[model samples]
Target: MSAVTVGQELASVPYDELIKNILLAMVAAQNEANASFIEGINDLVGTEVKIKYKEDSTEKEISGNALAFGILPTLLQIQSGIIEIKMAITLQQTREFQVGVKARMGFRVFSASVDAKYQNTYSYKVEGSSLVRIQVAPAPPPQPLMRAIEYIASKTAPTIP
Candidate 1:
């Protein structure tokens, strides 16, 4: 006799929660960066820096800290993603039996011999794995957030006398 069996993972991953947590972590990091940048920009916001370049004959000066002009753009983007899994298993059982008899007779007496054999074997194996992957790229901030940042920057600009 023979038997075969297949098996897979017993526990499942909660993909929805994993994705949500990842996105939330990204947002939290961005918020932290924005807060740090705004705090540092406060010192440079009111200060003016002069730049002199002999383009033709006149010097040009730009009075703004670029960092204070806008919030940092989002650098990570959730693009294409993929998940894969593979599983393999095997099970086997075997039984065998043998019987033999022999007899020899001469003139007066007879003799007989008997022999028997039995064997059994069993085997099992299992293998499996899973993979998760995600592709990402740099991305600009959302339009609404960009607009708000622009408005805030414009209002905070220092007036030149």
Candidate 2:
């Protein structure tokens, strides 16, 4: 008896299709009952605080839709504070956006780098077929809310437990 090895296979998915699917899924998830849909993510990576979203309205919609989906995405806009640590596409199809550290405070730190553009072509394979994969960029690093809490804490003295 001879042992034969077969390579794994992948699925075929189009970039545009993938993006549309993700957007649809997001909408669907938000529409789902008792489903918590997060439109935005906030966190404290370091000294800098960052907020990201395709549009601020997305957050409002998420908040309003929270009742059905159980989660809402909020639009975050930090006027003065830290800089954006990471940039993600979240949903990419016709256009390509790089994910990385960008500006700080109000000043632009790094020049925008175009790793891939709308013309760029990329593909993925799954289940023995090419799967269209939309580049879902990582959410921006969350801003630290500890400072606000600390400020409040400092204002108020600790009481006995």
Candidate 3:
């Protein structure tokens, strides 16, 4: 084997920075892959997750501050909801970690939906008009009172000598 000779040292990067870069890349990839889901999540944040039974059974929901959090939390909640969903999807292999499925009995099935959201305790509106309109209006005409104002004679009349 021939010995290699170099005049300058090789460039080195920090593990923390490398890890951060990898994490950012993974996050970006995840966002891209689940673009629609993310978009849906953003829109559905602050809304209720409702599960309804028979028409005679009335309604059920998870709402208020708990549901009004930001998109990330909402997405996480939705992710957690997979178990609540009880529907198997993306399963092909026998592996339990890779979106696999199994059969179960006596599990209740419910409808999931988004409800009107008034405000989120954990989230705020980031996009909207910030400038406030300054309005000025002329003061209202003085009203007649017992002693507040005296009716004066017309200016067109002159005082007699």
Candidate with top lDDT is 1
Report the number of backbone clashes for model 2: 30
Q: Report the C-alpha lDDT of model 2 over 1-161, residue by residue, as the tens digit.
A: 12211211122233344345556665454345212212131221112322334464553212211122222244333223222211122221221243552323332211111123311322222222222333343334434543543443344322222
In candidate 1, which residue pairs clash? none
Residues 68-135, candidate 3: write the lDDT tens digits. Answer: 33223222212211111111111112334434234233222221111112113213242321222223
How far off is residue 96 in model 2, in Å?
Answer: 22
Report how far off residue 25 is in candidate 2 (Å).
Answer: 6.0
lDDT of 2: 0.30
Q: How close is candidate 1 to the true structure, as a TM-score?
A: 0.35
Candidate 2 stretches with Cα past 4 Å from truth are 1-14, 20-128, 132-141, 159-161
User: With candidate 3 superimposed using the best TM-score fit, by how many Å does residue 59's alpha carbon deviate from the native?
Assistant: 28
Estimate TM-scores for all models: 0.35, 0.21, 0.19
**Can you tell me which runs of candidate 3 are displaced by over 4 Å?**
1-11, 38-161
Task: List the candidate numbers ranked by TM-score, top first.
Answer: 1, 2, 3
